[model samples]
Target: MRKTLCDTLGIEHPIVGFTPSEHVAAAISRAGGLGVLGCVRFNDPDELDGVLDWMDANTDGKPYGVDVVMPAKVPTEGAAVDLEQLIPPEHREFVRRTLDELGVPELPEGEQKQDGVLGWLHSVARSHVDVALRHPVRLIANALGSPPVDVIERAHGHGLLVAALAGKAEHAVRHVDKGVDIVVAQGHEAGGHTGEIATMVLVPEIVDAVGDRVPVLAAGGIGSGRQVAAALALGASGAWMGSYWLTTTEYQQIPGNAATQQALLAAGSSDTVRTRIYTGKPARLLKTRWTDAWSAPGAPEPLPMPLQNVLVSEAHQRITRSADPTVVSMPVGQVVGRMNKVRPVADVMADLLAELDETIVKLSDLR
Candidate 1:
């Protein structure tokens, strides 16, 4: 727990919990660890403000962070073609039918929902950044890649630390070049959008590539203290985690979104198909019937971001409303196999720190 992460973050434990729930955020920060709030699901700025404000009041000013999904590769930013123009009407129809087939009913009457018109593209991402910067957050983490240069500059200007995820050394190098404070070397075993590199290989590679330039935190397939030990042994300052926190007592699990169902659907979603159903990026997901149907040889090709996200957003909404975890997929990594039990947030933190200490002591004995 005395690593650079703990020292830099001024926490007694380096256990960073990633969850969208503000309750978990406050709990983790209260327990002396970084509680990173995920913002991809929230398209509203006011909702984010309320959540962060509540967390700030509850955590007694203990440091916490928020993560946003701003992919480095937007469909048509650097290219000539427009992403929206590229989407086909048949693809849209297919998505509508997919939702209909799933039986996700329309929202009840008078359910006022605020949705951004441009979707999660660059402009909306920047707006979310503005909303986040207004709150009392210690870190600004970009989940997909290097945050926009302007965003990073703005965070640094406000004295906030900026971090980004990397699947390779060159990606880490780009982040460092862009003045990213931390590089999370994500591997294939990670849930959501990930690269092909494995954690064991990518961590050291990033460390060497970064040198003394910036700190590197290992990600992907890191669910326990042993995995954190492996990351530190490979020269990372700490471990950035995601999948491990999904099954905690604080998470909003649907009826069957348990360990058994995760394993049962593991062969389908966990088999590692990088599809664009979620965010229009090469994200890893459980190879479910939906993803398989979209990825099948004769099936329609996935649409680009924003548009693709819009296509499946209705489907996800219906699935979650129905609480059917079998056909409705949750983004998770291979670490799902290990998250068989649910414990309190503080209890989970204690177990991780204790296990890390034991692992470190045993390794010292070995040396």
Candidate 2:
């Protein structure tokens, strides 16, 4: 699977693994793939600094990246207090009621819940960029859109690549125009925030549109080596996989949320739904009671990004702490059907390469 992307990123495989866990990221890079660490969950710059420090020490001098959510626009303005006030009481009450109905219990008196929507702000995202650049990060990716031009230029100044995720071909062009080094064409089948397009159609469209300008990485519903091969066949230089890494042992080691992993293992492709109930964007999430509640009649409309995210942050923390399977909201792709068991990151990477080689041989034999 060695391609131009591999050369560009100085990796052996054209696979780019996206995960929130630093262990998983380092493992992917050590296994000859580029690991992109998700930074949206880090509310404190020091927290991110610690993770990057661990990654830098553990990646065996391999290339890895950082992913941040830098939306082109936001609803709240001025200060953090202003942003919290943007969330209406009704929305907050709805979230609380949904959790109550799902039997998700509140956290213990001494323990505190994590801040969910803090990192989505521009200031926090900028702090992430600042922290990542201080380290030897090879790439910095923005999940929402093309990061500010200043971010792009700053990354370039440090000899780092800037990547952006686009759901449409035009979005890819815009990213390229903004000096993005890589464009990840994530389909509607992807986890977290996504747009309405399938990978098969979106990949080639993005490839044809920006094939000559920049490298394209295909995402969404891609969990296996066959899917990676298909992405390369469609002219993508690599496969940017997120859902596939969720079940890795390295990921499980972080926080060790076995309930979430168990839910993913028990899921089929159809067990997911695209709804804005989670992050106020059209994101694919596990069809649990929380997601189903939002679709019920008389359910209030979800507020826009940041507002809706803030509305449900505490509820999510409660559900997570409770470890309730029915109420857990894990962002996953349609490819969850294949994630049936937990495995080590090294073993998963080796199996993927082996499968790719076998698939290639079979194809060559057919001719």
Candidate 3:
């Protein structure tokens, strides 16, 4: 696991754990992998700045990174109020009807609904970049695609490596061309927003296209040490894992997450479905009644990038508040099948390395 990426990022293993939990991210770094915090959950730059401060104190001086949601092509940008106007009434009604059908309860009286994630907007994402640059972050990753050229340049100026998620070889090439320091070749089986290529094929294709120019990190459906070995065999410098971390004990510490964790523990590899109902982009999510309802007859087509998320943001809150595991909305990969137990992040990291070593010895004996 001691690849160039490890040396570049100053970590023991080449694994990069992406998580929204600051605790999980810090734990991964302390355990020797670079933990990249997902910044999209923070709608306010000050909130992100405070979290980074906590990360700085908790990571034990280990290098960690931040992942932002800056799309290659900017989406409609505006204040939350202005963006709310763009959502069609039909979509709002659909969300309301679905929540009613699912028996999801609303917030208590006088408890206002939390605003939609403004981080999906370009302005908010850029603010994330600005806040991240001020921290001691070693890497900055864009979740959607290649970030704007100026953003890439700014990260470089701060002496930070820039990485972008690519679902295609062409997208990988484009990232390298735009001066991206790393490319995360995330496959169709990945959580959150993703494309149609599977990891087994996408990794090598991306490596062949840009491996010589920049290190490619293989993502999607990677959860164990054996899978990490496979990623290395496919020429990836490291493995970028997201979904597997969701069941970590540290992640379970997040308030109101028990139901979502329970759902992940109960899932199998075949229990996932790729749908555009999440973030208005094709994202792999746990198969739940909510996702199924979006596919039913008379369900309107999902709107594009930010709008769909805004329209359904309140509905997601209601679902989470409802505490129904069968109806919770979560972006997770097929790896959820293997995420049966809630263990410490350190324990999971140890198992991954142990499995990788065992796999290496088995393969060497065959020679």
Each prediction's Cα lDDT score?
Answer: 0.74, 0.88, 0.92
Candidate number that wins on lDDT, 1 or 2: 2
Instruction: Please provide, for model 1 over 1-367, each residue's C-alpha lDDT reduced to its tens digit, 9 standing for 90 to 100.
Output: 2367787776667667677677777788888888898887666677778878888798877899988878787643421135435568888688767666656566567764323223356666677789889987888888877888989999999989998989989999999999998888888888888888888888999999999887788888887889888888898888788877766676643343453244433443245466677766777776666676676676677767666665565566555555555455566777766776667778878877788889999999996
Candidate 3: tens digits of C-alpha lDDT, residues 13-105: 988999999999999999999999999979989999999999999999999999999887788988889989999899899889898898898
lDDT by residue (98-177, candidate 2, tens digit) is 88888888788978665666677888899999999999999999999889999999999999999999999998999999
- Poorly placed runs, candidate 2 (over 4 Å): 78-80
| Candidate 1 residue runs with Cα over 4 Å from true position | 75-86, 100-119, 253-272
Candidate 1: residue 231 Cα off by (Å): 1.0
Which scores better on lDDT, 2 or 3? 3
RMSD in order of candidates: 3.7, 1.3, 0.9
Per-prediction tally of clashes: 3, 0, 0
lDDT of 1 at 203: 90
Candidate 3 regions with alpha-carbon error over 4 angstroms: none
Q: Model 2 clash pairs?
A: none
